[model samples]
Target: MGHPMIQLDNLDLKLSLGRLVLNVLYIKSGFFYHSMPEHRHSNGSYELHYIPSGHGRLIATGREFPLSPGSLYMTGPGIDHEQITDPSDPMFEYCIFFEALPSGRNHHERLYGRSGGDSEDIREIARLFLETPFWIGQDSRQLQHVFEKLAWEINTRSIGYRRNITIQLEQIVIGLVRNYTNNQPTLQTAPLKTLDDKRMVLIENNILYNYKHITIRTLADQLGLSVRQTERAVHKQYGMSLREKLLEARLQEAARLLDTTLLTIGEISEQVGYQSSESFTSHFKKWQGLTPSAYRTRTIVPTIQ
Candidate 1:
């Protein structure tokens, strides 16, 4: 297997939601290509390669693996690797790069963490994915569908497609990683039952139903726990106080409305349970570094342009 020459078309790339990054490469039809030389990524992002139509070979860490249509390969950050495509058959592949964050790190750093699970679980998962040379001869129809959707969004640049594509890619990457993890032996740990686990579900349901009028005392009584106990449970589960989580949920909803709808800032504030525009502006500014009007102006005005 050798690297072949094919026309590479760069599609629109955007950071729509979280810290994840995505790039779609289209190898124009009829371009006979083989091989991507060994390379390393400094940013600690993992690479997920999906081959839709072609055959190839992968060389990584002194090992060679054959590539075929529906081949899926994963390489972690800083790992040098290369792929050799069969020159006879041109193929298309979508490369997804993402960083998995730790539980309590900033959004950006969390994306690059060593693993997506606990340390032990991540070690085993990473080992399995890296050791498995190539997942060839497996049906990759679902993956092909995902790549097609991504390709459509990238080429068309349809209204709101950037956001849609980013989300879809995230789901796709997570699904693939999860599938790999589930097949590994480390994820078979015994489940632990905690009082807060049950209580948090009840609390989340309550908040979803009536976030507008939610109060500490009311939640405490509804959960049949003392206010102090309820508060501790929430903090333990989410690493934030109950009040903070409530406000976060509210702000997240408000941000979505601001981005997707034509709602006025004042109206949006009220919908998210802010009693006063001033209070909402203060809180929004603290979390998002921009007041409601300013944030809307920055995010929505460009769409019109």
Candidate 2:
């Protein structure tokens, strides 16, 4: 533990953490000997590709950019992109895909092994995705070192390797953000994101806090966006329809009421925006396969037993 570390240069990217959830999907390195076929990432996650050797061209959003060793670029959710190798020199790169968990704490804590020291580290990692711009061209040997470490950890599959790779990913993000912001590299790129972070956060907060009263018109008006625009943006960014998000919000609230309130099933349904108790019961059954009354009873019986 005595190994000294270099001080990370200070950089700023006005980040806010309403809720930070970063789930790294996979990390891999590849060497391409020929042109890559056009493909799109359909899974709706943030992506990064960094080339440490060779030369190529990256085609994204119908635009082509110079690609060479140490050039880092991004492809956002729902974006179609492709790469062309330099033919003789080909191209070798490291690619990573990360999805932001919408909600869920148990799954995250289970993966990263939060030994009390990793929470702050995890927040720093989340800042990377929140603030990082797409397509950086800086060639940082330091970053390359961290990426290679991840590649090795992933490839070898040692004990606790999952945790190892996760931790290293956080470090790599922190390092890259610090370096990129400080240097202010001239390469221009932005994730093909369709929603504003602040607005999206506000919408999610409003939905969670006021599920019973939130309406598409009121929510859209509050954001100064038309209803159609609001729906489109929500679907684009979250990969779920507005109807789905609202239903989830209502379902989440109904479950909470079932657990914490003595209100009758009908009253609880009304509280969560259902007009008729019967209608609420039907929806609740479909959503949870348990009537509101049954869910409440099930919860209470567990405690009593």
Candidate 3:
């Protein structure tokens, strides 16, 4: 709120990962003269800290890591950590608190409708972030610039600032993931032996990201696998038949739309790959124990003035 300190909260910023949304709880950029008390993030939340200048120390789950300019680290869900700033120089810190929310398809699709490698890349990067528990390293991606831009976007609230914030958030996530992975010695020492693993990830991303229009044959063709092979792979990976997999994807997205959007049932039906509202309602009722409209009504939170 004063010089050398800025805190932005309740900003309603979100980053999409097809079905999972990363909601930014708060962001702070300031000189840390006071120490951050020990705390833990539960329910699969995360906090990222970057020290652009000065000095500090992070005590995480009984392990101590010295912090200084360019120090970057992440504390994931259930990690006990605290930050103590060196009073002599007081660390200039950029901290982001965020949590992942798993919803259905419509919200993510509305936020990011793009397909192909871009979407898949975001998915993979997000996966790494979620899977990693803790990492401490120096900046290799010049993430300070991205944080500066994020702060500017929030302060100015200019045209397209929300979109800009989303992009910057994506960059921050990518930077963090890269920092985590690039610093890992095992990732290089034990490289994946085959392209098969990457291809499977691609196939899963394609189905999840393009569930509305993806077909087994088209997906197989795109991935250079025969239709039968694709079907077999899908069943093995998901333990579901091809038709079941598609149906599950469509329903999952439909459920997300019901919870997070005001789209009409018919509109949501089409968006999630149903040819007709009747068919959508029949499948949804069977899957969710309620009609589409009923599910929305049950899940939607009423806004208070």
Model 3 residue 177 lDDT score = 88
Lowest summed lDDT window (length 10), candidate 3: 185-194
Model 1 spans > 4 angstroms off: 1-32, 99-141, 182-305
Q: RMSD for all candidates, in order, please.
A: 18.8, 20.7, 17.8
lDDT tens string, model 2, 122-195?
Answer: 55445445444344556564678787777676667699976776678777666665655566633432233434
TM-score of 2: 0.46
lDDT of 3 by residue, 101-196 (tens): 645455445334465334766666655666676788899999988988888887888999889888898889888888877898112111111124
TM-score of 3: 0.55
Candidate number of the best TM-score: 3
TM-score of each: 0.42, 0.46, 0.55
Q: In angstroms, give how far residue 116 of model 3 lies from its true place.
A: 9.6
Candidate 2 runs further than 4 Å off: 1-18, 42-44, 102-128, 131-133, 183-305
Q: What is candidate 1's lDDT per residue for 1-305, written digit by digit as tens?
A: 32222333443443322323233322222322644434433222345677767776676654667766766766653445656667777656666543332233653244435544436443444334333332323433376676666667656779998687767665565456555644442222111112322354466555544667788898888888999988886665445676886777677668767855799989999998999989999999999999877887793322110
Q: Where is model 3 more than 4 Å wrong at Cα?
A: 1-4, 105-119, 185-305
Question: Model 2 shows how many backbone clashes?
Answer: 0
